[model samples]
Target: MCEHMRPASAFWSFRENISPSALSVTTDGKHTVVGTQNGLIFLNSRGRPLWFNKKIRKVADVSVSTKSGKIAVGSSQKVLYLVNLKGEPIWHRELDSSVIAVSISSRGNLIVVGTDLGKLILFDGKGKKKWEVHLSNSDFPVNSVDITSDGEFILAGTDYSHLYLYDSNGSVLWSKETGSAVLKTCISSNGDYLGYLTSDCKFSFCVKNSRMLWENTFDSQPLWIDMAQTADFVSIGESSNKVNLYNKSGRKVWGFANESSRMGVMASGGGNVILGNKGGIFNYSLEPYLKRLLTGCKRSIIKATEENLDVTESRKIYDVASKNFSNANFSQFLINIHKARNLAREARVIESDSVPSERRLERNEVEEDPIVPQENTEDEMMAKLVQLAEMREKGILSEEEFIMAKSKLLRI
Candidate 1:
């Protein structure tokens, strides 16, 4: 068996008074922009807070330019602000509906905003309105938006369960019905792949042709998702206060948990990840994890071969790992090596038990699903109902909204 190794830990982290509603990491991983319930924050690569702005109230989304570090923020108050690195607003625009999402190009030359009014608007770096398109009715607002690094492509998801891809000029390239409300969406840096999460708790990845590569469903609803530059890695934050990393094939590499709720996550092109919430901003690097995994896999294969155990499957896996390593695809190399090590271990067990070749166990991949919270009891449900009623009385919910929510809560 291979020796155990230490796991990755946060490189740097710090807390704020408010939980982050959204997170955006630059392609180079040098900067991060966070949208909080009551303000916006900018952090450096070392996790030092550079500046904070309380003027951008109830920030729903944030995006940072990959090359220029320009920030575009969307707020629930129906305002979109383009801010400079020093946290000063360069320009602010008010829309007829709530601004829900924003994405800025690499050079900070283009910006896109998705609104509660179901409109997708594009603006130049100087805040000029380039074009606008209404993808759905007001009831089906655009919930997420993403733009390629070069600003040549844009992707948007809606509450109506639709996903649309558009060129730089706002022409629709294609549209697909996702069959569930798309909570969030992201495009790869080169626009080759797209990732999205649905209200049904399913995370999916697809190619430019709209072919779904793979998908996984979680019991706990996801709060945020971001894809790496080439879509080689995907990261997700969940309401369960956990962050997970998955590879292109939908295999989870690891999960990080914390005491506080994790509401936002971003995966940088350089294989770095950042997670944010009321607890703090946590940064992590995948290098350590992948290195240990690769080392352990090599050891396991050697051990199995020395013990004269069946090494056919393990050899094949190792061959693939060699190819990935030759190509400098470290992520895929480590993943394949991890799989090979598991197979090698299984071979040892089968050989020691003298299991017949035909009856050899086929190892099944085990997935660590999120822990589901306990269902509320009658009294607890009653208390929640009372709280909902109080919120409605305070005008937090319209009559139609309140009735709909109550019905869903009561299963009536």
Candidate 2:
């Protein structure tokens, strides 16, 4: 299934090391290379560790070439190590400054590193120097670097707000002033698009030729951004709330909200995206885009049942969706929920005029059982409000969830 249409499933999650900060993940086909403050850990598709290298302390960055399955690790100790799937070192390069960023090409023929001294170095697969570039404006340090899958384009971002694009022979293609500081940057697998997030909280995208395709500014101050292999979409992870999804055209497609700020984001060949944080990593859907659609379906189903429009079918579908909402098999649940949504939409069409109010239903307006009497008096509503407030205060629900539930109670 194409990832943009495939339903998402939450898969195995692994906790970050005790340090939590300075975390990243690299995907090399079937292997996942995780870089933490302490060391490098390799995991398989099932999130099982295949091998680990604790010898490199304070691993600052990691890159994995999917075509060649070569793993690159950069450390604060000013060293870069290239290893294979079995965790065997192929070569090591000691640099002049602490390594801050690293990237590997798809076939593993190209390697690039960014350092605290504002130097960008490129190396061949055999550890031979290909080219190097030094930036005088990288005073804030070289924080992020990336190379195209075919190893044709190179990108480096610094805290001084300068972004440099390089060609295969180490010549500067172009440079731009993005923002006060460049937080992160990524390149599409085919080398057609480049995306970046800035310290001032702006996420922007550009074509390979440096023409601005689209740009978006955010208040969440996203921590990381990555381009999908197809360059059709980008994912930005915010420090406080949602991990947002945007298309190359700058359309906001989806947002996955969590309590914590995930550290890094990675895209898969199938368009699936993974997020890593202290609580572990989570897999979220990129294709089917059902989260919003499902919510609308639930609202429509309730309205249809209350208006007596194909009541039997609407209620049946509603019941199934309610059960599916609690189901552990999320991928299957999404598929089934979508079917239920179709039923709800059909039911609404059968009796469109029955609901004269026509106001879009709020989250609080939908009754789990539309047949149940919800006409509570104001005093009764206050009592329920108190009840919900107590539940929220008791830590029985997340603050956001509590607020939503309370809003629903007030609607009653």
Candidate 3:
């Protein structure tokens, strides 16, 4: 059996002040954008706060294009804002009805939005309206919508349970009915596949031929569907704590069902899945064919420490060390483990106690790379470990190289 590595889950690298119920999150496995009651928060890859704005309110939904750097925020007040990474709105427009759903194309040229009043509108990246239409000549608010990477095909579901595929020119390609209210829907990155869930628990997928490929019912209704650019996996975030994973052929591969009812922040990566919630974010490798890890943080203690960011996510991995220390028979190893845990907890307190000036931080802003580290910390050991893990994930450090470095750290 492969040896257990460090804990698979940790709080995102830094910062938090999120109000759980009012937050909407979206990620492309790299950058994450969060929509709150009065503002939107953007984060770099390591979860460092980059910028936020207090003007946008009641964000109904948000979308991020992985290939393109554009971010879209749809508000319930009949407006949508197209913004860049700097949190500056490129443009904002008022729609015909309250914006219920919004999506951005990969090329960042087209955006599609569904209204609560049965209207669908398409726009260019500059927030200029291209076309608008009311579905079925009546009020059947569009529920969910997605655009292909090339802006060619648009998939939208409405309150009347109708699904329509429209071309960029506002021409209908085809339409179908789910026999119940459509809850959520999404299109694959290449625009070849479309999948959706309905009010009756029906989960279905279709191919480019406009033919139904497969359909099934779920015990728990899905709240959202996520399909990333490179992976063939489709993630179904259900109302239950479960997030189900399925292949393109509609086969069940695996799932993660920990924490709350929603998989609030998600991104798929090389044979693995990353999830974030009110508690924090975690990175897990699916071992077996693809499944993984071992490190527990007595759930009650974690729940209790939820508000204490200084001790929670950032110090979580040390909980594993805590467990290991208790059973260790060697005195020297136990001393080191105890010392390491203390240092880790101290690191958390130091991190949480400090705040960066938003204006001053812009000078450190990365215009071209979001994932690069901008600063260093006082803890060299932890910093080195984080660097090693990043290198391993990026394939800069081989498994053997990582194991060698990790073993040395554990010895300390």
**Top TM-score: which candidate number?**
1
The models' CA-based lDDT, in order, is: 0.73, 0.66, 0.60
Candidate 3 similarity to native, TM-score = 0.63
Please give, for residues 276-336, the per-residue lDDT of candidate 2 as tens digits.
Answer: 6675755554444433445656666666677676756655665665565454333334445
What TM-score, to 2 decimals, does candidate 2 have?
Answer: 0.66
Note the clash tally of each candidate.
Answer: 0, 3, 6
Better of 1 and 2 by TM-score: 1
Question: Residue 163 CA error for candidate 2 (Å)?
Answer: 0.8
Point out the higher-scoring one by lDDT: 2 or 3: 2
Off by over 4 Å in 3: 1-17, 20-28, 263-412
RMSD in Å for model 1: 14.3
Looking at model 2, report the run of 10 residues with the lowest lDDT sum: 355-364
Find the candidate with the highest lDDT and give its number.
1
Ranking by TM-score: 1, 2, 3
Error of 2 at 16 (Å): 6.4
Please, what is the TM-score per model?
Answer: 0.68, 0.66, 0.63
Itemize residue pairs with steric clashes in candidate 2.
Answer: 4-287, 5-287, 14-280
Report how far off residue 140 is in candidate 2 (Å): 3.5
Between candidates 2 and 3, the one scoring higher on TM-score is 2
